[model samples]
Target: MKVDLFDFDLPQELIALRPVSPRDSARMLVACGDEPFADKSVSDLPSLLQPGDVLVFNDTRVIPAQLDGRRGEAKIGATLHKRIDLRRWQAFVRNAKRLKIGNVVEFPAQVRALAETRHEDGSFTLKFEGEEPVELLLERAGRMPLPPYIAGKRPTDERDKSDYQTIFAREDGAVAAPTAALHFTPQLLEALSERGVQRETLTLHVGAGTFLPVKADDTDDHQMHAEWGRIEPETADRLNAARRNGNRVIAVGTTSLRLLESAADEDGIIQPFADDTSIFITPGHRFRAVDGLMTNFHLPKSTLMMLVSALMGRERMQEAYAHAIAQKYRFYSYGDSSLLIP
Candidate 1:
C-alpha cells in the first residue's frame, strides 16, 4: 500500500502536549466491527476486558538518551540513540557536519566520547571514556530524548521524568515509551489482578524511529530501524494457553504487539525470542499472536498508523481517526488511546 493511504489531518489543538493529570482519565475509543466508536475513560478498561483475557505489556523503560557535549573546541550535541555495549553507543550527533571520525567529545563532568565511525544517516558509533556503565553515564550526563515536535531545550524537566514512562516499567532499555501502557496505574493493575485478568510481560526497546516520519511515498521502500526485543518462554506458554482456551491475548501497545507478532508462527504457535527485529508491519500482514490491541493515537503517514490499519481495515481505521478528530481526542506520544478489537 502507498504510505499516503495512512495519512489523515489532525488539528494542532488535538496534539497533546501534556498528559491528563490522572493518566487513566484519558479517553479511550473502542471500535469493534461496525459498532459506533464508544467514548470511555481508560479507567473503564477493566470492565471492557474479560475475566480470562491475557494482557501483555512491554516492560522496557525509556532512558535519558539525549546529551549535550563538545567535540574538542567545537560545540556539539547528541542523542544516545541506542546501546551497542557497556561503553559504546549509536548516537545522532547535532552539528555533525563538521565532525571527523577521530574527533573526541567531552560530556559533562569527567565523561568523554570519541566518534569511532559514521553511518550514512549521519549517526555515529561513539566510544565512551568512563568506568561508569552506559546507563549510569546517561543518567548523569543525558536528558530525556523527547520527540523533536515537543519543542524543548537540552535538558528535560521533572515532569517528563515521570510522564514519559509507564508505571510498570522495570527493565531499562527503550528510547521511546510503549504509550498504551502509560495509562495503567498501580490501582488499575490491582483491579485487573482482583478481576482475574492475567498479565504478562515482553521487552521491546522502542527506538527513536518511532518518531521518525515516513519519508517514503511507497510504503514498501521504507527501511525500518532494528530494535532489541525479547519474549520469554514463560510468557509464550501463558499466551499459547490462553489462545487454546479461547481467551484473547490483548497487547498493550504497538511495540508489544509487534514483538508478539514477530515471535508468532504461521501455525499460531508462540515462541521466545531475543534478537533485533526490523519488522515493518503494514496492511495485508496476517496477525497470529494478538486478538486485540490497546494503543495511543498515532501520527499521520506513520508506520504505527499503518500497523493499526493492518488490524482494522484501512477504510475503517480512517473513519475511526475522523471520529477521534471530531471528538477533540489527543494525538501522539502523550495522547488519548483506543482499543481496536479484531
Candidate 2:
C-alpha cells in the first residue's frame, strides 16, 4: 500500500502535551467491524474483556536518554538510541559533523563520555567514563527524550519524569514508552485480576526509530528498524492455551503486538522467542497472532498507523481517524488511546 493512504488531517491543538491527572482517566475509543466507535475511559478496560482472555503487555521502561555535551569547543547534543553494553552505547549525535573517532565529549559536570567510533548510519558508539552506570549518568546529565513534536515546544520538565513512564515499567531499556500500556494503572490491573482476566509480560525495548518518519512513498520500500524483544516459554504456553480455549490474545500496545506477531509461526502458533525483530506490518499482511489491540493514537503516514490500517480496513480506519479528529481526540505519544478488534 502507499504510505499516503493512511494519512489524515490532525489539528495541532489535539496533540496532547501531558497525560491527564490519573493515568487511566484518558479517553479511549473502541472499534469493531461495522460498528460505531465507543468512547470510553482507559479504566473501563477490565470490564470490557472476557474472563478467559489473555492480555500481553510490554514491560520495557523508558530511559532518560537525551544528553548534551561538548566535542572540543563545538557543543554537541546526543540521544542514546540503544544501549550496547554497561559502558558503551549507540547514539544519534546532533553536531555529528564536528565529531570524529577518539573525540571525547564531556557530559554534564557529574558525568563524562567519549565518541569511540562512528557507524555508517550517522550513529556513534559512545563510551562513558564516569563513576556511575550509564543509566545513572543519564539520570544526572540527560533529560527525558520526548518525541520531537512535543519536545520542540516546551523543555523536558519534572512532569515528564513521571508522566512519560508507564506504571508497570520494570525492565529498563526502552528509549520510548509502550504508550498504550501507559494508560494502565495498578488499580486497573487489580480490577482485571479480580475479573479473572490473566495478563502476561514481554519485553520490547522500543527504539528511537519509532519516531522516524516513513520517507518512502510505497510501504514496501520502507525498511523497518530492529528492536530487541523477548517472550518467555511460560507466557508462550499460556498464550497458545488461550488460543485453544477460544480466548482472545489481546496485545496491550503495538510493540507487544509486533513482538507477538514476530514470535508466531505460519500455523498461528506462538512460541518462546528472544531476538531482534524488523517485521513491518503493512496492509495485506496476514496476522498470525494478536486477536485485539490497545494502542495510542498514531502519527499520520507512520508505520504504526499503517499497522492499524492493516488490522482494520484502510477505509474504516480512515473514517475512525476522522471521527477522532472531529471529536478533538488527542494524538501521538502523549495522546489518548484506542482499542481495536478486527
Candidate 3:
C-alpha cells in the first residue's frame, strides 16, 4: 500500500509535551471489534477486560543514550541505537560529514569514544575509551534520548528522567522508552492485580529507529530496524497456557507485541527467544501471538501506525484516529493511550 494512505493531518497543539500529573490519569481510547470507540481513562483499564486476560509489558529500561560531543572544532551529536558489545555501540551521528574512522569524539566528564566504523546506512560504531563500564560513562555524559517530536518543542529535563521511563524498567539498554507502559503506576498495578489481570514482562531494547519516519512510498519498501529482545521458556509456557485456557494475551506496547509475534511459530505457539527482531507489521499481516494491544498515538505515516493499522483494519484505524483527533486527545510518545482489540 502507498504510505500516503496512512497519512492524517494532526494539529500541532494536540501533540503532548508531557504526561498528566498522575500517570494513570491520561485519557484512553478503546477500540474493540466493531464496537463504537469508547473514551476512558488509563485507570479504568481493569474494567475494560476480563479477569484471565494477560498484559505483557516491556521491562527494557531507557538508557541515557543521547550524547553531545565534539571532534576537533566540529560539534557532533550521537544517539546510541544498539549495543554492539560491552564497550562499543552503534549510534546515529548528527555531524557525520565532520567525522571519520579513527577519530575520537570528546564528550563531557572526560568520556570519549573512537569512531571505529561507519555502517552502510551512515551510522557509526563508537567504542568507548575506558576500562570502566560503558553504562557508567553514559550516566556521566549522556542525556535521555527523547523523541524528536517532544524534544523539538522543549528541552529534556530532570522530570523527563522519571516521566519517560515505566515502573517496570529494570534491565537497561533501550534508547527509546516503550511509551505505552509509561501510563502504568504502582496504584494502577495494584488495581489490575485485584481485578485478576495477569501481567508478564519481556525485554525489547527499543532503539532510536522507532522515531524514524517512513520514507518509503510504499509499505513494501520500508525496512524496520532490528531491536534486541528476549522471552524466557517459563513465560512462553504461561502465555501458551493462557491461550489454551481461552484467555487473551494483550501486549501493553508494540515493543512487546512485536517480540511476541517474533517468538510465535506458524501455529501461534510462542517459543523461547533471545535475539534481534526487525519484524515490520503491515495491514495484511497475520497476528499469531497477541490478542490485543495497548499503545500510544503514533506519528502519521510511521511504521507504528502501520502496525496498529495491521491489528485493526486500515479504514477502522483511520476512523479511530479521526475520532481521537476530534476528541482532542494527546498525541505522540508523551501523549494519551489507546486500547486496540481486533
Top TM-score hit: 3
Per-residue lDDT of model 3, residues 289-323, tens digit only: 99999999999999999999999999999999999
Model 1 lDDT per residue over 125-156, tens place: 99998687878888888777777766442345
Clashing pairs in 1: none
lDDT assessment of candidate 2: 0.89
Q: Give the per-residue lDDT digits (tens) of candidate 2, residues 155-243.
A: 99998988898877999889898989888888889999999899989999998889989999998899887789999999999999999
| Segments in model 1 whose C-alpha atoms lie over 4 Å from true places | 152-155
Clashes per model (N, Cα, C within 3 A): 0, 0, 0
lDDT-sorted candidate list, best first = 3, 2, 1
lDDT (0-100) at residue 330 of candidate 1? 94
Indicate the worst ten consecutive residues by lDDT in candidate 3.
Answer: 218-227
* Winning model by lDDT: 3
lDDT, candidates in the order shown: 0.88, 0.89, 0.96
TM-score of candidate 2 to 2 decimals: 0.97
Q: What TM-score would candidate 1 get against the native?
A: 0.97
